[model samples]
Target: MTLPVDPDLRPVSVATADGSGAHYWVWGDPAATTTVVAVHGFRGDHHGLLPIVVGLDDARVVTPDLPGFGVSAAFDSGPHDVDAYAAWLTTFCRQLHRTGDRLVVVGHSFGSVIGAAAVAGGLCPDALVLMNPIAAPALAGPRAVLSTIALGYYRAGARLPESLGNALLTNPVIVRALSEVMAHTADPALRSWIHDQHRRYFSSFADRRVVVEAFEASVSHDIGEYAARISVPTLLIAGDRDDIVPVAAVQRLAGELTDSRLLVLADVGHLIHYERAEPAAAAINEFLARRLGGSTSGRP
Candidate 1:
């Protein structure tokens, strides 16, 4: 089924640093010299990166599926921990980033958190842009607990025909949690596409053990301190109505970054780039133009 999303942009596979078979999409534009590498959210593929890809023009766009997500294969233990994900990404960039390419890393939600970790661990991009990044979490209520337990049961159920797995995805509370998690994207097109992907991707998770491990890692990992030490020009964008990551958390992240600017879209939810693409694009464009002007010539 074709859900709502732009069909124009496509990804090009790049060699993985650790020989992990990572794939990324590149929107090439000769007029634009800078290459903005986009990292997607948890359990999210590069398609979910459309809003961000469209948000920036006059620059080449690159969106990649990190390990244990999207087209990237799961490692032996999966990419369970935040540090491991960042380490893998740090290696990916070191191998793929061209010598003369001006680099900017844009990460959304879980991707943003991982991006911050990557920066602190020495990924060394010129700037870091985080959208609706997770600073803290809203506790999962009774319903959340029930849903997790139920998903646990379903995951352990008897084997069925592979094509018939969609039936297992039928818990309302689970659906609601997904709805809440995805509240970050305000655009219907973007939202629907994400929802559709959840239905599809959740059913086809590559390695269950690794995915669960990664999920546990994400829940336990917090990079507020590392975020604070960032010396690069950083931009944090938060949607006031976002349910996944609280605006307060986004603000806290902004406070941590030494050279950072924050934007709070009042009435806008997580997918502000899709719902209010122009202004969002303008914010990023203005920042990039100011920072990337007259380059120092040699930096990753």
Candidate 2:
């Protein structure tokens, strides 16, 4: 990915409060055209796509591990809804030294939906790059059913029996299924680190309190309807063979956004940035060059 601009960047704490626990990594020169805030997918940590962010030499990179992941694992809060995430983003952005108004949020999978919801609710960054984004309708099938059921179980366990939260979180079958979904990586260290993050899962402050509340708040989170509200350029990238997010969601997004572009690549997986790093980096660089007042001199 463009020779890995900041090849071995280190992670640092970025939150101003203990309750707001967040770890981040900054790549490239800070005085670039714009800063890219890369959000990781579900169960992923901050360093998940370091290579992808570092590849774009002309842009500054800022990545965070949301609560329940990475160094923010100890962050116990009210709920993990889009509003909370969006608020955290706003708070964090204001803290960036001399960041100066230009922002481009690039979210992957679950992060994309959350970012879209954030953008809709006025977290309006300059541009949105959704990679293998999870659209509302695509998550309306078995995934939704399972999510709703989990929330219900988490909620009910508080009143009736204390089985749901513990059982589901530690359930062998469910764990196996989740593990399978994360089986895309072959690196032992990376896989082990991610699996540990997943295994750190326990009952939240309340069973499914945060997730259930987030699910409700995120019910009508349609990125398309909000895409029109986004006052910025946008890009939607999808891998036809993504295991978690369907490519059709990207197609739906393309039809919804007024100033947006779509790029579909074959033989790539859900974690396109991690799997096909070079091409993904090229696409991102090319996009910024064409849309963000930069020249397409050396960009692919």
Candidate 3:
């Protein structure tokens, strides 16, 4: 799953007042008047959104590696929760946005929680797109038990010697298992690519404390409160096969939002963008055009 980097795309860093910075990839003209800011989910980086990026045309896109993942610095100040992330993102957007410029904010998985918080906190993006939004932890059936076991194991692993814990988390077998569990697609090629990506990048998140804290924060708070307050037009994408964030929860979230439309992908799962990038991107493009009044055609 090696993607071609756009010739105009380059790595950029946005420094915070606290001396730490967030790193991201930028695509399209550097001086574009409108920007799409995409945030990756838990255990993901800018690479996770490459397929979606390919489908976007006619606008500048910026994808950031949230605080503790990818090449970005860890959140050394407050808890890695929605509120803290929203605050950081507000600053990051302010740095990128010029007067009279338009913005569309997109978030995947846990990133959606942060996006909702940011909008509720008055970040003021013109449109919001939430892909595979997780309203709460999937605490049903065997998956619930497995999730509990995984958390317990993580807590125990954290207590081991630092080197031992890191080695345990980064083990090839464990990484492969974790990656496979995140997907529901039957496409062998796509599954293989996802496993490889997760083994190489997702499992290599070096900060154990940040990993545990972020995991806890992801399922702790309900985004419904923020959803109710969000005034921006929103497109909510859900995968019917998503075990972690079921379509039922997504429907409930849509009901809670002030203005939104929910799209359920029949055979897709948590990795909506990865499994169905073309359709995902098309859906996003349509949303941007119809809801946000942007361009009609998208990129290849």
Best by TM-score: 3
Q: lDDT score, residue 135, model 2?
A: 57
Of 1 and 2, the candidate ahead on lDDT is 1
Ranking by TM-score: 3, 1, 2
The TM-scores, one per candidate, come to 0.78, 0.74, 0.91
Q: Model 1 Cα RMSD, Å?
A: 4.9
Candidate 1's clash total is: 5
Task: Write the residue-wise lDDT of candidate 3 on 1-300 in tens digits.
Answer: 446475234566665634457777777656656688898888788888888877876778888878888877887677677788888888888787667767888899888888888889989998889998876654443367766777776676678899898777667888787778777878899899888777666864548877777777676655675877898889999899887776777888899888899888888889987898888888888888887564622322
Q: For every model in order, what is the number of clashing pairs?
A: 5, 0, 0
**Error at 260, model 1, angstroms:** 0.6
lDDT of 2 by residue, 114-225 (tens): 7776777777577788887765553374356655665565455434445655465446566556665744666777566545444543223233344445445444354665
Output the TM-score of candidate 1.
0.78
Sort the predicted structures by lDDT, highest score first. Answer: 3, 1, 2
Residue pairs in steric clash, candidate 3? none
lDDT of 1: 0.66
Who is ahead in TM-score, 1 or 2?
1
